[model samples]
Target: MHAVLLLMMMVFAAVMTGCSSGPDYKIDIIKELYYQKDKPSPFEIKVTEAGKAVTGLTVTADLSMATMNHGTVKVKFAEGKDGTYAADVKVPMNGKFEAAFLLKKDGEKTEKVIEINVVKPEGVAKINGQWITDKDVSFYKFINQLQLEINRDAARKNYSGKQLEEELAYLDSQEKVLDDQNKLLTQIIRLRSMALLAEEKGHKVEAAEVDAAVEKARGQYAQFASAQALIQHYGEEKFWDVEKQQYKLIVLAQKVQKDLVDQAKKENPKAGDQEIYYQAQKQYEDLLISQINSLKIEIL
Candidate 1:
């Protein structure tokens, strides 16, 4: 009986030792950090072992998407005097970004998903009470940056004589695209203002849907570095605020289109399909452009 009791006590002690042997790795995600979409952004991840610092462990961050077009970004961890694990992350866009981190120590493994909400620059560029929104400015900057690029390229190649003239003519012809962009910009501003009005009138965009739509925009610009770079150039918070404005414009544009279609149907129910459709779209786009120019825009 004495021998059996002693054996049982020994086994219990061994089990307790095993349970207490390994360090409990804990990962805490810090929120609301800002980073440029084009450059590396640093994020803090706090790790604790039984509420104490877990030193000499490795941590890494990995981002995944359906298609590998954007590629992946990773950062290793270094010990900080604050007893927290620090890693720099390069967020590609203001989309549905997911990050996974791996923590390893003494043959033990831990994984965590850190939520990253990267927004476009805030106050990117604001126009009067209703002419433009942050998104319009972001997009404008993006398109203007493209124009800037063409100019840069032409300058670098030293185009002169007919070449320079031809280039100038081409640039001149692109005035329409600029016009369209300006129109779009106006529409975006109007839309944001309208959305604000809508919300005041008890209309609200579904949160999940807004999130999904924002993600869709990110997906659309996934390929264009100019777009992404300009966004990053402004930084994330402002960038996202701009994105929200863009979304509002798009929604407002759709609403305006729908209203026009409804009016056409009412005025001339038998109107030819192409006539009403074509005129409405053109008129709507024009209305927006005109309004944008009409507004007081201040750029700093």
Candidate 2:
């Protein structure tokens, strides 16, 4: 009986020691989970102990909600770089979620529970993780349609009756083309891509330049009553604010164009100004294509 008692005590002590082992890990949500409509949300978490990454562990998760009858979502995480594990988890809806994670390494297992929030991105597309929001696309459409109306109003002076009807009809069709979302997105992408390259090339647009460009645009629009009415409808302050941002980027893009024009002139001193400008324009287009291809663009 004494020998058996001593062996039991030893086993209990061993169990206590195993339970008291160090380096307990904790899992943290990387970001508020962004849920997709057509597929599983890309869920990510980081595992750390003593503020250091805990790696080489197998992590599996069960996602559930306390208020819902929906079955739990079983997730098998795949490790990414720097102690991050990701799983494409499909949840019933966007809201609070409890993630029960089981992390195993070297026969040692740790369980942790983290509360997560899932939401949807506000944008229809993304470039390098920067969202081009739906409202932004809507504003572009509005601007395009407004410009068409301005042209139609100007054509009223030169044409009348049937001729005026044809001109207005053509302008209306142009508005329809402008309403294409992809076409507007393409325009935005082209402008942003060129502006990005201009910044990389160390081009800077001063506030004075943006102001001058805005004034130039304002003066051009001032000639048409329809332009004034549209600007008033859009709210002059808001319209000018948006125009200032666009013109700032345009100023940057102009600098990029000027750089190409200068390079063309230097490369072909004998070429006339017209030929040089044509070559520069082609080079600018090629450069824009290359830059766009390098960007991380995603259209949802």
Candidate 3:
């Protein structure tokens, strides 16, 4: 066990001797095991041999608590792109844990042990190394549904029979897929990046500002019965709790937008509101790209 811990700490050096292999397999951690209770926590790793990726190797892990006596759980890895392999490991709880990885190819068998600290997932991904929590994902899903439900209600009222079915089908077609999920994650990243830039520019998101923004949204949605029903379904207090956090960032971004709009207006004194807004939006996108490039982003 002490030998295992030592090899785990070495990270890139854990290896085994095999007649058919070159330079001993180098195992690297791609993603760590995260705590998900009895649910599967994703663990990813990359395998290399002789300075090149080695594919078609079978891999598995025996997971066990490091500090306490918890029975070992076994998980098998499925091959992924390149030399990457991933496994969904189920653990008894979140804490210090260790995994003993067994890799096999041809007649060669290699074992690599690694220490993994299992904690609650910070986020589905990271922005400048900050975790994007499950809460963020849920809120995005909810807010998107708010508009969809409203449209659904509108279709029910204005269309009937086959026409209604077609409208409903169109709405269903809009349901989120992998691309939409990526888009939402990108949006979350963009908003956060802009908000951080706003703070750097000395814009403050006060509680009053957040409250006002949220209230404005509430008032706008209040006209739609479907919106109200959705809010009720999530519990109004719970809905607003997440919403307020979202609006705080939003308000900060809005401040940045307002600054850009002000700049556009000054430059185009004769421009109408729409023209000014369009200019500001273009500037905002350009600035967002610069910010994203300058920052370190990681998708976990």
Candidate 4:
């Protein structure tokens, strides 16, 4: 019985030593934390051990704003493509909040805490007061594609060093043009935002109208053998879902522009067709600038 008791005490000491050693991994927040109130704000946390990503871990987050008396909210993080754990959390309001990450792996548990600031966004550049990064990424991707195309053409022509340098300079000029075009596209998005506002105020484009527009667009893709072929060319699900929404937005923008022009005509009955159109265009441009100025647009 004494021998058994001594063995038990030895086991207990070993267990205590193991627990006291703490976790072998380090947890770090990947980037600056800025969240828009009530929006799904995505963040990444990296776990590393000896300069390598620590895999196969279960990570969870608990968030609370102490000063604001906000209660704790729990969030589960999923493993991301780059070996980091990611989560989209919605904070209740605009303020400073504390986020505590609890990580568990192979019966070992560890934790890290971070503070984040949430802010309310302003103006039409935001959708539901949240800044979107998808459009920004898409814009840069397009620019990169343009650069690649230019390089391919230069290579095909067998351009040497000096010629290659000139070609690259020309590509830089083209990039600036594309950048200007992107600015115009952003303005159009702001115009679409105005359309969305109109939608909130009971102005809606009918489903039938959107369906007709989509059908018309499909008709323009006659080079494809069938709708399925067209879908395959531009990703089946994306062509249907994302392209359909894009068509809807286009139709809605058209309707909004027409409404604005009609209002302009009514307000200035003596104005010619060209004058009314120009006035409506100017008004829309001014509105976009106003919206951009008023919005809190943070890229991160």
Candidate 5:
């Protein structure tokens, strides 16, 4: 009789527990996405339900365009500390790109479409509206590497914990300089794509020139056992790839400037213009150096 009574009680408890539990809430991706700068460029995307948060939700973005093609980027929704779902999608080219977000929860899936324009970049105006080239990234990366080296040196010298911490804090401040430069560069590239096209059409720099520039830059690291080892540490293909890209951009910008000067000369032949092409080339080289410095590039 007692066993029967206990069983009845357990059954009642199980029923009550089921009744107390609430239904799983549903989250829908509402269309709101924006880049850091634009208010209405349609870069905002979100999934929300009752102001709560969701994690591990998958978001995929795809783009359809008449000129450029972009496929989906698989991203998992990362929960913000404040309980919001977020994912980052890097835009590839400037055009109208359609994005779809796929959300999976409780073995069910939901998807939505949001369209955004990959506008040509219009960041802060610098000298001549030059597109931020890969070289800008390289310069920023070089500064980061320098800071790392300095921290390593300070450690080797056996600085006090407090002193080392202070030094590291100072280094941290400089790190953001690169981040800002990178953001600027992204905008510049977007704005100056036309100039880039012109450069791509007119001139090509040889691979050997790029290789030589990279090798010369590596001289600062001669203390390392081998250049190969340094390259391996930095990444064999990636470091060299960045160098190649920078050199190509350099060549491209030079050609574009020359094209401009050439047109000017053609428009006025008897003005005794000193080799406008050569003059343009020199001006571009100087500008490159100035831009590098402005970007706070330091080789540690």
Candidate 6:
């Protein structure tokens, strides 16, 4: 009986030791951005305890300029994938910024501070004469949606263990795919910039044309039970506004392209339709490339 009692006591002590050795809470700042005025600067923070992601935590940041006497800017972070918290903070101006992060989980709170050197980046992304941070944010949202769709398809196929990991790894390593997506985004931005230039040159698309284009797009979804339901499913007000604006921009771009092609054909009256179009496209792309090359584009 005494031997059995001794063995039981040892087992209990071992269990306690294991429990006490579990992970402690920790925070890591993964990504920092250069501070810009009135622009959303994004930061990525990862929270873990014992090297495992900690979910359901409330995270916020207090940002202040380190070198100068700038007031604090408070920002609430939103939860992202893999125990990461993300927030877009706007600092007053460029300088050394100190960010103090407060993390709260289950009534327990922890604090961490990180210093970031903030300077105006030459340019991460741009088109023509316009900065495209807002457009890049929208582009990232589309990229994230595509990633989610890929994950969903993978899950549906029941890919598990090594096979699943390999599949995802392969997808991540597809530089060509990512490059193509970026090129497409750049093309879209180029088109929008061209439209803006056209507008500056006193070329405009009528509101009636935009409205007609939107109505035609809406008509494609007529099989849906209700327009309201379709709109809601696609994000309602914001989606419709963006949709209309995109259509307007596209119409303007098409008009500009047509004008350019017509001018090219007028200059070369004996040229084939294909030849004129090719020349016009080449001219447009060359102009865009020249403008882009003039800007300092730094990919972050």
How much does candidate 5 score in TM-score?
A: 0.32
Best by TM-score: 2
Alpha-carbon deviation at 130 in model 1, angstroms: 7.7
lDDT for every model?
0.62, 0.84, 0.84, 0.67, 0.53, 0.70
User: What TM-score would every model get versus the actual structure?
Assistant: 0.35, 0.64, 0.61, 0.43, 0.32, 0.43
**Candidate 3 vs. truth: CA RMSD?**
9.0
lDDT of 2 by residue, 88-130 (tens): 7777777777888888998887777777776787777777777
Best to worst by lDDT, what's the order? 2, 3, 6, 4, 1, 5
Query: Mind giving the per-residue lDDT tens digits that candidate 5 earns over 50-141?
Result: 76655555545454554565554344556543334555545444666665556556656665665556554433223343433445555546
Record all residue pairs in model 5 with backbone atoms less than 3 Å apart, i.e. clashing.
32-44, 32-45, 33-43, 33-44, 33-45, 34-43, 34-44, 121-190, 121-191
Error of 6 at 68 (Å): 7.1
Instruction: Give, for candidate 3, the lowest lDDT window spanning 10 residues.
Output: 14-23
- Backbone clashes counted, model 6: 0
Two-way lDDT contest, 1 vs 4, winner:
4
How many clashing residue pairs appear in each of the predictions shown? 9, 0, 1, 0, 9, 0
After superposition, the stretches of candidate 6 with alpha carbons farther than 4 Å from their true spots are 1-181, 219-232, 294-300
User: How much is the lDDT of residue 226 in candidate 1?
Assistant: 56
What local lDDT does model 1 show for residue 11? Answer: 100
Model 2 lDDT at residue 148: 86
**lDDT for each residue of candidate 6 in 1-300, tens digit (9 for 90 to 100):** 999999999999999775552336677876556666677777677888888999988988888988788799898999998898887777788878887877877766677777877778554554543455645546545444445444545553778888888876766565345445466557566766667756766888899999999888777544334444545665766666777877888788777778779889999999998999999998877766665565433333
Give residue 163's lDDT in candidate 5 (0 to 100).
Answer: 83
